[model samples]
Target: MITVKVPLQEAERAKQELMRQGYFLSGYSVQKEGDHLYFPVKERFDSPYAFEERALEARPEQPQGLRETLKGKLPADVLGRLKTAYDQVGDIAILEIDDKFKGYDATIGKALLDTNPKLRTVLAKATGHEGAYRTQHMRLLAGEDKRVAVHKENGVSLIVDVEAVYFSARLSTERKRIMERVQPGERVLVMFSGCGPYTCTLAKNTEAEEVVGVEINPRGHELAEENSKLNELTNVKNYKGDVREIVPELGEFDRILMPLPRSAETFLDVALGASHQGTIIHFYSFLHEDDYAQADTWIQGVCDRAGRRFELLGSVKCGQQAPRVFRWCTDVKIL
Candidate 1:
């Protein structure tokens, strides 16, 4: 077999480039030699790395994905409407199927299960997030009939009840980003913290003096406490109540996180009440790409009304909620 010999420092970049060009051979493990790595390939190609002949070990073939498994099983028009992307929470897969394909949901769910053997259950979104808790209903389409899942991220385990709580596994990277930004011994507050994903992640991964979470939803708060215990974190505390009523009692914090993208602006005063001078606030909002700057304006308006000076640190597009609309995070520092 032909192999691409690359230095350990350049292995990742070389491998990615080769894979992008459809030259990297799959089903075989990359061989590592002292100070160097060899990537198995089908044929010699023009590259900076030297191509050499070597016998490589073959690994088990990867399983087919939902799209591949459903090919020929469903009509092309229907298959095209099926999005391969699904939110995976531990052993559960949460799918978003269009209402037009309601009749074929079971077939699609079964195909997903066949493709991903590790998934223990599959659910379809039954309704949009609603009520005071922002929790949504889920219809079990395959596997076990359970809504609870134990999700692990950023060295912390979270007990999430999909039907009773609002939790997004998609925010794992954003949670990690906030965790990495936390300074040692700083007190952090997470508003609308569901299942303690942010609070527990910071507690487990950062040396923060204390990480506090306030959740309005009773079920979310209960799970938040359970998750803190599940992760064996002692520096975390959770309070169940409206932020407007609970935040004033918690005093000031060095950092405050507002993760409620929708209507988070309505609670800006509560978050501001818990922030002191030099405090950093991460505010989340959903807005069209063209109007993203509106988030900054909202923060500015709130600060003006509070008679507080603030400086915009940065803004990031965390995830897309719709076409050209995104979940955005705007970071600011109170002056």
Candidate 2:
């Protein structure tokens, strides 16, 4: 598919024309590239740069009753099962369910599409998760992609134009990917595990003997349990309570995922003293790339206070945050 970048006015005009005709808008992205604004569209595979080029060759005229293609029908039984939690936006269908889900799967996404015999090639399941369905009507995410399952990330997923939200760092996908570096067969202590993303991912993806996930929030605790079941991860446990009181009592661990980005550095003492030789303490922060050396100095200072040394394991780009603010995680091995 051709990814074309155009101006906003052009994009709106193109979008209207595409809908007025019979063409489907596959991908839509309006982004800021340095000083220029761009609207990117994914072109039809067999078409020219303009969708009209393809329309010219195949149908001479814009086909009749194009909106009929969108109001595609699904089975009554399916709609009955989905309840009234679904809202249709043009060709896209969205389902909103209040869930602290156990794990992610396709069976959970039975509402993204309906078997529609109305179009030549049904364009269902195109609009995945969006940001509008957040709990308490708090606008957190743009929306959940309907086609992409968070657990099915072993495969391809949709792309989203993410925005900054208050306390949204706790929900970042970087928190999930960096946890992949954790070695197997290690007892992990994940403080502030949120919804157990790191805990369950570690358990299900590794051969860990035990993973103790701790969260203080009651709703988070319930969501963690649900996430544990969703991923079907074994050898993992979720403890619902503040970790400051609970962590010291849990004894020692070979690894720790200190994920509370704002104060992850403050927990360094607990991580160092609680760790044995070769233990890795994964820490995330809002520091700039140049500040990594400063972060290392600070971490090593904690190591020195604890009568130990640490080996810096470097950092990587998690995702983009706001203007000039990016989130990154650095690993250090305890000596």
Candidate 3:
């Protein structure tokens, strides 16, 4: 095996480009010196790197299992638990690590970054999504020390502070699903629109005349406004206030999106106020598998109390949170 020495700062970018062109060794880890980084390559190319036909130092081949590799590298008792799943927003990787893995966070983070060269930072979630802002506490485990994430979805750019607001790449499909249902020249309202993912995507992809995103968190609203400009979306309007107060003032909308899964049921009345007859409402909620009827019942009950007939357009599982708990979205028309 031969090694190629690349500038330390350019190593990651060169590695990614090399991998994309099918030149990087799959099972080898990058070796670094103070000012230069070395990579194992099959043969020398015309790239800007110093190459030498030196015998490679012996090292263990990269393992397929992340946890197994970490266990082999760290003290056995330090890794009490491991979470292998994470959400990547642009160059940032977000996930939770057990408290027992505190001292080993850098090791785990290095492994994560080594495996995914495109990632520049890793944030370990310290607490659940709590408080009125629906924000999660996070700590920088490795790589760059920045929290701002620039995520692109369906050709729209979303700039958000992960710790200040809620952003989920898992909901990319759900966002697209909702965006497809919107028609041109229609006014849309997205309640609890975090960082303008839904609003910007809709405004950029669809011809919605006006897309108003109502968010209670001031920071989220600020980012949403920034994202709208970043994506060059002129139709997006961000309101920084409670949905209950903002929705009523916006009058009626052709389509309304309630994305707060845990507490969307409580805000149905306000959503109704912003809806006219034949208005489409996309309601998201978390429900157990056995009680499938709970979401429909609650939505229907809300419509009935408001003297409006509800037409169930569709119901589908958006994503799963646990074994039995699932995030479900229902599309309904108010008549």
Which model scores highest in lDDT?
1
> Which of 1 and 2 is ahead in TM-score?
1
- With candidate 3 superimposed using the best TM-score fit, by how many Å does residue 331's alpha carbon deviate from the native? 1.2
Whole-model lDDT, model 3 = 0.82
Q: Tell me, what's the RMSD of every candidate? A: 6.5, 14.2, 10.2
Q: Give the TM-score of candidate 2.
A: 0.54
Candidate order by TM-score, decreasing, is 1, 3, 2
After superposing candidate 2 on the true structure, give the runs of residues whose Cα lies further than 4 Å from its correct spot. Answer: 1-179
Candidate 2: tens digits of C-alpha lDDT, residues 162-239:
111112322324544655566667899988776566776677767778999887766566767876777666788999
lDDT of 1 by residue, 133-227 (tens): 99899998888999998876656778889889999877776887898899999999999998899999999999999999999999999999999
What lDDT does each candidate get? 0.87, 0.52, 0.82
Model 3 alpha-carbon drift over 4 Å, by segment: 1-65, 68-71, 75-80
Q: Write the per-residue lDDT of candidate 3 for residues 143-255, one digit (tens) a residue.
A: 99988978766667788788889988768768878888898899999999988999998999998999999999999999999998888888989999988777888889999
Candidate 1, position 242, lDDT: 89
